[model samples]
Every structure is written in C-alpha cells, then in structure tokens.
Target chain A: MTEIKFWRGFFSILLVISLLFFIFHVWAVILPFAFGIIIAYLVNPLVDNLAAMGLKRSRVVLILYLILLGAGIMLAMTLIPSLIKEANAAVKELPAYTTAIDDLITKANGEIQKFIKPIFKSKSDVIAIPFAAQKFIDSLIPQLPQKILGVAHAGLWIIIIPFVSFFALSHGKSWIDIIFDSTPSEYVENLLGFMAELNATLGGYVRGLIIESLCVGLLTIAGLWAMGIKGAVLLGVITGLVNFVPFMAPLLGGGLALLTAYFQFKSFSVLVGIALLFIGVRLFDDFVLIPFVVGSSVHLHPVIMVFAILAGVEVAGFIGLVFAIPVAVVIKVFLSVALRHRKERLMFRHEHVYS
Target chain B: MNLSFYRLIKKLFNDENHGEEMSFLRGVPIFFGLSSHQLGRIMQAIQKRKYYAGEILFQEGQIGKAVFIIKTGRVELVKNVPEGGEPRLLGNLGPGQIFGEMALLEHRPRTASARVVEDGEIFLLYTATLEALLKNHPAIGVKLMRNIAVMLSALLRRTNQELENQKKS
Candidate 1:
C-alpha cells in the first residue's frame, strides 16, 4: 500500500511538470484560448443563471455574444474618431515636443551638475547621466514600429477569443463533470472543495478588477477632459488597460498625461493640475474603489504581491504581470488544501492507533 | 427569422428534463419550502452522479465535505466496531433522504460510513457551493437552515429517547 502511494505521488508530480513544460513551450499558441477561458469563467455565472431558468446553455451564450457585439460596436462608433484624431495630432507634434524635452533636459542637467559638483571629482561623470538618458530615449524610438506591429498581431486574437469562449461557456461544466466521473469516489469530495474555493477566489478577483479598471478609466477621462488636456480618451483607455498591473496605471498613464499637458500648453500650472488629478485619482482608488470593489479577494502580503508582479514580468512580460496574482492565489489554495488533507489523515491514523 | 432562429437553437442545444428535475428537488426536506426560482438556483450548484450497488460513498472517520441526497437509490449507513467485530448497520436511507448533512454545518469526521445498497443516482452539494448560494441569496439560505435545524432537533429528541430506553432496560 505504501509503495503504491509512493508511485502515485511520483507520477502525479511528473504529470504536473510535463503539463507545465507543455504550456511553457506553446504559450504563444495558447494565448487566445487562455484569454477565452478567462472570459468564459468571468461570464459563467450569468450564463448559469439563465440556463437555470430553462434556457439552453448554447442559446444563452449566443444571446450574450450578440449583446456584447452590439455594445462593442456602439462604443467604437462613439469613441474611435476622436481617439484617431488625437493620435494623429500627437504624431504631427512629436518633433516639436522632442526638441522641447531636449531643451528642458539640458537645463535640468546644468542645475544637477551645480548641485553634485562638490560630491563628484570630474565633469564627465556628471555629463554621463544626461547623455545616457538621451541615448535611452533615442533607442526606444527605433523600436516603436516593432512594438506597434506586435500589438496589431495581438489584436487579431480578439476575434478568436469570443469564438473560443462560446464553446467553453457551453461545454465547460460537462468537461468538469467528466473529470468528476473519472476521479475515485474517495477523492471526489476533496476535488469539489478545491474547485469551489478556487472559483470563489478567482471569480471575485477578476470581476472586481474589471469594475475597478472601468471606474478608474472613466474618472481619468472625465478629469483630463475637464482640464482641456489633449488625447483624454486615448490616455484614459491606456490607463485602464495598464491598470491590470498594480501601480502601472498611475505611473505610465499619469506620466504620459503630464508630458502631453506640458507640451500642449507649455504652462507650469497645467502640468501641476495634471499631476494633482492623477494623485487624486490614485487616492480615490486606494481608499474607495479597492475596499468596495476588490475587497479581500487577494490576501498576499504587500512585499509578496510586489514580488509576484516582478516575477510575472520576468517570466512572461505583460501577460505574466496580468496573471501573477491569480496564479499566486491558486498556488496558495492548492498548498493549503493539500497540507490540511495530510494533517487530517495523520490525525485520523493517530486516533485509530490509540483506540 | 425568429422561428428559424428558435429552430436552429433547439436543434443545436437539445433541452433537458429540467422541469422533472426541479419537481424532484422540490420534494427534498431541506428544499421543501423553496420556490421554483430559488430551487433553480440550487440546481446550478448541485452535482449529479450515478453509483453502482455496493459502492462506498464515504467511510466513517473521514472528514465530510459535501452532503449527499439520494435521488433514486437505497443507501446503508454503518458504524465500525472498535473491538474488531462486524460493523453495525446504523440505518437504511432511500430516495429523497440526505446523508453527510453534518458536513454542511461543520467540517468534521463523518460518524458513519455510507454505502449504496442499490444502483441509483445521487446529488452532491459541496459545502462551499452551498455557502456561496446562501451568501448570494439569503432568503433561500434562511429557509434551508430553518428546515435543517428542525430536522436536527427531531433527531436529537429521538436519540435521547433511545438512550432513556437503554438505561431503563
């Protein structure tokens, strides 16, 4: 019996490692299906509710897709033209903004050298700082076309996502049921408990994130537009997209908005106003949106959360960063459940021996 | 177009006997007072499975995580004897009877082992799923908990009587 258990454990570990290896190797191909599964998971409760009302699952999914398609078209019609115009204007004014930034950097470099002269022995060391900064900016411009092409390629997957999600929503439950049927009855209850816990944690986090991002994005658009900032819609959408990663929204979104405001108006007051708007939005998000919307879905320590985000970026770039917290939550739940089960088994054995 | 759409949907996704299932669930003691709408919500959380005769649903001393409702089967609850004697038969449960219900209230070792006496289908409701349902729909939760409390109180009274009779004899 002990030998059987040992082999079972070993094989289970081997299977899991093989699965992870397969996923890692085919990540690019799996991206769309992964996104579809996520979307299906998020929208499942509504589908289940309607299905419970006697509607067929496939029918419900089809109806939902139609509604979403209609909404998406309406939104695009309203928002796309203004966004394109703003983007075009920004591209046209890029050279002038670059010159202005260069001038500002030179002025700042002079002040920086004056302050650090007493500490540094040579002027060359001080000049190196601004030179490296300029070199970095120059390097990024050349890579813009490649990055844009990558984004466009990813955009093609948007069509495939809904197609994949439709089947997933309709057939996902039966797929789970098949697994349940195959599992030994002894471990079925444990599997059900694990799945239930996972559903609660991941479902709450994903739904809460969408709502929070939407609220933050709308607030940003309103604030920037009120202040007559250029490209308010474009900047707000980017903010919402990057809000998937913690702290990226404010840093990237706010920085871009500040630069735009400075270039467009060239007023210190306008720059300060843009800065204040971002600060206010961040404060609101931390105090109100997070507590009310996200609540306690994720309970990782702040340090661990930051580490997970960094590790995610290191592993899979932006996609990894987006999935980091959910993946961490799954690992935490799996370990806790396995450990608890082991402890219970040991305690049971101990009681039996005593008896 | 509407008729064709309906026909296409019906052809693509065949309808199940949801009405029959809902009526069956409505007869269960815990769900006795629930309306069709509330019962529909519960149906979403419950998992149905078929068991063969002589299959062990769960063993005594194992931690219970889900409550099982016999939809169409005979189940026998047995207790293991400590002195290496034959196991004692606790009771025979039939269709509409629930077992492992204590799991819904708390996570503890099951007091008796449940085995299927006849081939039939059963519905399993995990405690976490029930908790989610209760949290989302408090009205159903209140009704279900009240029925469970009433059933438990009756069981306690019966057990007390049994103990008194044993003492008198």
Candidate 2:
C-alpha cells in the first residue's frame, strides 16, 4: 500500500508538470479554444435567460452563434479594411514622423545651447550633447516598422477565434458533462463545485476586462481627437490593449501619447494637454469605470498583486502579465475554500469531543 | 474517418445518455412544475455520478454547494460521534429522494455524511446553476425555492415533535 501510494503521488506530480509544459509550448495553438471557452462562459447567462423564457437550449445556442457570426462578418467586411488602410497609412508616414521628431530635437537642442552658451566656452561642447542624444533616438526609430508588422501578424488570430467560439457555445456543456462522467464519484461533487467557483471568478474578470479596455480605448480616441493629436485611433487601440496590464500599462500608454503630441506640435502646451487628458481618463477609470465593470471582487493585497504580475511576466511575458490578476484570484479562491473546509472539520471535531 | 464514423462516435458518447437523463429528471418533484422543455434545459446542467456500495459521497462538515437526488439504489446519511462510538445513521434515502437540499440556497456545512448503502446513481444540481436559472427565469426559481421551503418546514416540524417526545420521556 505504501509503495502504491508513493507511485500515485509521484505520477500526479509528474502529470501536473507535464500539463504545465504542454500549456506553455502550445499557448498560441490553444488560442481558439481558450477564446471559445471565454465566449461560451460570457454568453451562458444570456442563453440561460432565453432558455428560461421557453427557448430550447440548442436552438438558443444556434441563434446566438448566428448573431455573433453575422456581427463578426460585418466587422470583418467594414472595420478590417479601414484598420488595414490606417495601418498602411501609418507605415507610409513613419519616415515623416521620425523627421518631425528629429526637427523637434534639433529645435530643442538650439534653445538649450542658447541658454547655456554663457557658461560654455567652446561651441563644440554645446553641439556634442544634442548629437549624442540624436544618435540614440535615431537607433530606436528603425525598430518601429518591425514592431508594427508584429502587431499586424497578431491581428490574424482574431479570425479563428469566433469560429471556434460558436461551436464551443453550442456544445461546451456536453464537453463538461463528458468530463464529469469520467471522474470518480468521490471527487465529482467537489470538482463541480470548484469549477463553478472558478467560472464565477474568471467569467466576471474576463468580461469586465474586455469592457473596461473598450471604454478606455474609445475614451482615449475621443480625448486625443479633441486635442487634435495625430494617430488617435492607433493610439486608442494601443491604450485599450495595454490597459490589461495593471499599474504600468497606463503610464506607458500615456507617455506614448504625450511623446506623439510633442513631436507633432513641438509645443509644451500640447504635451501638457495630453498629460491632463490622460489624468482625467485615469480618474474616470478609478472612480467610475472599474467599479461598474470589474467591481471590488478580487480583494488582493497590493503587495501580492505586484509579485504575481512580476512572476507572471517572468514565466510568459505579456500574456502572462495580462492573465496575472485572474490567475491570482483563482489561487485565492482555492486557498480560502481549502482553509475554510479545514477549519470546519476542526470545529466539528472539537464539538464532537465536547458532546 | 468519414461523417458516419464521426456520427457513430458522437452517438455512442453523447446522445445515448441524454434520453436516460431526461427521463430521470422528469420524475423528480422539485422539478415537477417545470414543463418538459424547461426540464430538458435543466437536464443539460445535471451532473450524473455512480458509486459502489460502501462508497462515501461526501463527509459531514463538508461545505455543501449542491443538492443530490438519487436515481437508483440506497444511500445512508450518517452522523459521526466522538471517539469510541459508532456513526449514527440518520436516514436511508431511496430513488427520487433528495439530500443536501439546503445546499441549493445556502453555503452551510453538511450535518451528516452520505455513504452508499447499495450501488447507486445520483444527479447533482449546483447552486450556481440554480442562481443563474433564477436570474433568468424568476418564476421557475420561485417554484423550486418554494418546494425546498415546504420540504424543510416539514422536516423541522417532525424534528420538533421528536425533540418534545425525548424531553417528556
């Protein structure tokens, strides 16, 4: 029995390691399936509502799938082309943007030299500072096109996501049922309960994140457009996408917008306006958007949140950072449930002894 | 494989069990008020499990999150005593009988452990699933909650009478 138990423990640990390895290696290949799961979970309440209204579950799934499919097609037809056009335009205008930035740097350097000329004896020393700065800035410019192309490649995954989601919505329950059926009866109830809790945690967080990102992106576009900033739509998309990363993402997004504004207008007033606009958005995010969409559901300590995000980044880079909070919430749920269950057991034992 | 092969595989795995599940769900009283269509919707969410005789389903003090209804065979609800005493049998439940009913509404610790007396098949309905159902269709939610309330009250009344008898004696 001891030998058998030892083997069981060893195998289970091995299984867990293998599973993690598999997930890490095939993360991109699993995107459709992951997105499918999210789609099914997000749409489940709506399906249940319709089912309660006397609609057949399968029929409702089919109808929802059709509606989503239609929307996706419509988006692809209209939005994709415009987005592509914008991307192309942005690419073609890259040199002009760099030239503008170079002009601003030279102009700023002259102003700096004039202010400091009285202190500096040699004119060459005054020219040296700006020349080194310009060289460093120029090095970064060549990498911009590669980064843009990388984003364009990532956009291709969106096409496969919805197709898989439709099938998932229609038949995800059966897949769950099949899993439950195969599991041991002793663990079945606990597993189901855990899955339900996990669903509640992740469903709310994922859906909320998507909505928050969309709101932030749209608000950013509107803000930037009002301030007459170039690349408002592109910057808005970047802001929305990066909003998934807590604390650091907004800072980076705002910095980019400010830099773009300064380059285009070459004025301190424009940069200040951009910064104030972001501050306003941040205030709205903290006060209004987050509370309404995400809620105060995951009460994780700030210290833990920071560590988890850093650990996530170490493991999986940007994707890891995006999933860090949700994963932490899952871990918190499991730990609390286990601790509570243990406490109940101890209390029962204590009472039994007294009785 | 061809379409027929895929169909055969699917039929063997998924479709064959739904008829059995649907029929069993139709017989449960908590689900009586719901139409066949509504019952069918509920049936999709039902998780079925089979246990051998002497298998433990759940332990006392376990946090209950779902109600279980027996499909076949017997289950005994047992409450443990302190050290040096045998477990006290609370009740023996048979086909169509439900246990852990309060779990559908509240997150409470189980008062008794459930163990199979005979090999059994059971259906579990989770509270989260019910909550979703309630949010979507309040009427159905109300009907189910009312049935649970009625059942609890009857159990309470019986327990009160038993306590009175024990006190008098």
Worst 10 residues of 2 chain B by lDDT: B9-18
How many backbone clashes are present in model 2? 0
Top candidate (DockQ)? 1
On the 0 to 100 scale, the lDDT of residue B120 in model 1 is 94
DockQ of 2: 0.22
**Candidate 1 lDDT score relative to the true structure:** 0.84
What's the lDDT for residue A248 in model 2? 55
lDDT of 1 by residue, A290-341 (tens): 8988775567777877888888888778778777876776677667767877
What fraction of native interface contacts does model 2 preserve?
0.22
lDDT digits (tens) for residues B1-169 of candidate 2: 6999987755543444446666776677787677765776676566777778988888876778899999999999988876748988889999998898888876767778899999878888888766755655688787788878788898899999999999999
Q: Which stretches of candidate 2 lie over 4 Å from their true place?
A: A1-6, A54-56, A106-160, A226-228, A247-250, A262-273, A300-321, A331-355, B1-46, B50-54, B71-73, B80-88, B104-109, B117-121, B127-149, B164-169
Say which candidate scores most in TM-score: 1
lDDT of each: 0.84, 0.76
